[model samples]
Target: MKKVLLLLMIVIAVSCKNETKKEVKKENIIEVDKNYFPTELGKVFEKHGGINTWRKVQILSFNKGEEVHTVDLQSRRTVINTPKYSLGFNGKEVWLDEEVAGTYKGNSAFYYNLYFYFYAMPFVLADNGIIYEKIDALVFEGVKYPGYKISYKANVGNSSDDNYMIYYNSETYQMEWLKYTVTFNSKETSNKFNIIRYNKWKNVNGLILPSEITWYKKDENGLPTAPEESATKFTLPLISQVKLADSFFEKPKN
Candidate 1:
């Protein structure tokens, strides 16, 4: 009886030791996988250019259906700069030119430029705004993309009326496209504006910038209407004559 009892205690000790060892091994495996999390790609995007860099841009808008209006947009310090100045004009008359002393009043084109500027900073901004989920994996233009689907509630008073879902390209660590509906004060709602592709990634002072961006806009039924439009083009001059002032973006008060 005594011998049997001693054998039972020994077996129990051995079983407990094996269980502890297995648990430690499992934890180590989880740690290794965590290192490959997709959010880390934001650091890569930042290394290229990211959203932190400030730049001046020219935005050209064309009427998709009719040939009535075409506009030029001049913006300074798209992201960080506050009280941003934008000058706009339809091909013929002055639509919006708030920068100059004798310019026109506010209009829809002015509001459009403002919305574009806010979307300049992609990943970091989204992380702060809402929840993100890993969506799928995709490849574009020979680049691999591990996709992440993001959903968030917009801030009160934002033009984006509904909750938004944006898909981020994993390999590039940038947002490829997003879908959302917007409500304007005019009581009109449109579900247009989808980013299709990012082209011409150029390095500006160690920051990779997509000089050309294309997106889609569809009508209510979601039919492919117009071939997407290239949103903006930034031409960085090798040498410049005019000195850029720190207060360039500030609105000159009357």
Candidate 2:
């Protein structure tokens, strides 16, 4: 009886040891995959709000001009509302409802999430299928800002040929400027890049987001020449971890 009791105690100890080992291994795996962004970009993400926190967000909404734009971050479903018109993407289709005849003249498809992508910034650049490369610094007013060139895998989106450059303050690791090429309806990619300066930021739900973005006129060399008078500004930025129902983003019936 004494020998049998000793063997049972030994077995229990071994079992507990194995369980502890499994738990440690699981934790290590999560830590390893927690951050896959490049060192500098990871710092930028951490400075804004950790990438893990951004991934937890379900809904983001803000006002652009008189239009109120809301997006489902996970699904990419969007709704833009104005007194004159309502436009939205119901996961699969882009729809428009005009209160006034011919009120919305913009392309519904292209304009759906255009500003959302721009406003989301560095976080959106961390999306899947993206290729990142460290690039030479950008100098503006004698201040050198390091940056990264972002490209996408073939067949990634509507315009996979599109390219983006993210320039951030070296000391603060905060995004300062963005330069991108528009290839939305082009067969061949162009080297021409348009620039947008992130002039102001506001914190929403612990994430630092653009409150104002200024478009700059490009010089003959495809660099920013001067800030344009008309800048895109945002207000009432809100984020929620709770997701909205699909019906909310669906096309509305007349």
Q: Which candidate should be chosen as best, given TM-score against the real structure?
A: 2
Q: For candidate 2, report its TM-score.
A: 0.85
Clashing pairs in 2: none
Our model 2 lands, by Cα RMSD against the true structure, at 16.0
Query: Deviation in angstroms for 149 in model 1?
Result: 4.0
lDDT of 2 by residue, 1-254 (tens): 22223333543464466500111122222221376766777788888987888998887887898877888889889888887788889888999988777989999888988999998987999888987777777778789888888889999977889989999999999999999988987746878888999999999868999999999987665666789777889997877666676777876677
The per-residue C-alpha lDDT of model 2 at residue 95 equals: 94
What lDDT score belongs to each candidate, Candidate 1 first? 0.37, 0.80
Candidate 1 minimal-lDDT segment of 10 residues: 19-28
Model 1 root mean square deviation, Cα atoms = 23.2
Q: In angstroms, how far off is 246's CA in candidate 2?
A: 0.7
lDDT of 1 at 125: 37
What TM-score would candidate 1 get against the native?
A: 0.45
Whole-model alpha-carbon lDDT for candidate 2: 0.80
Residue lDDT tens for model 1, 162-218? 334344555555555444444555434454535344544555444454455556655
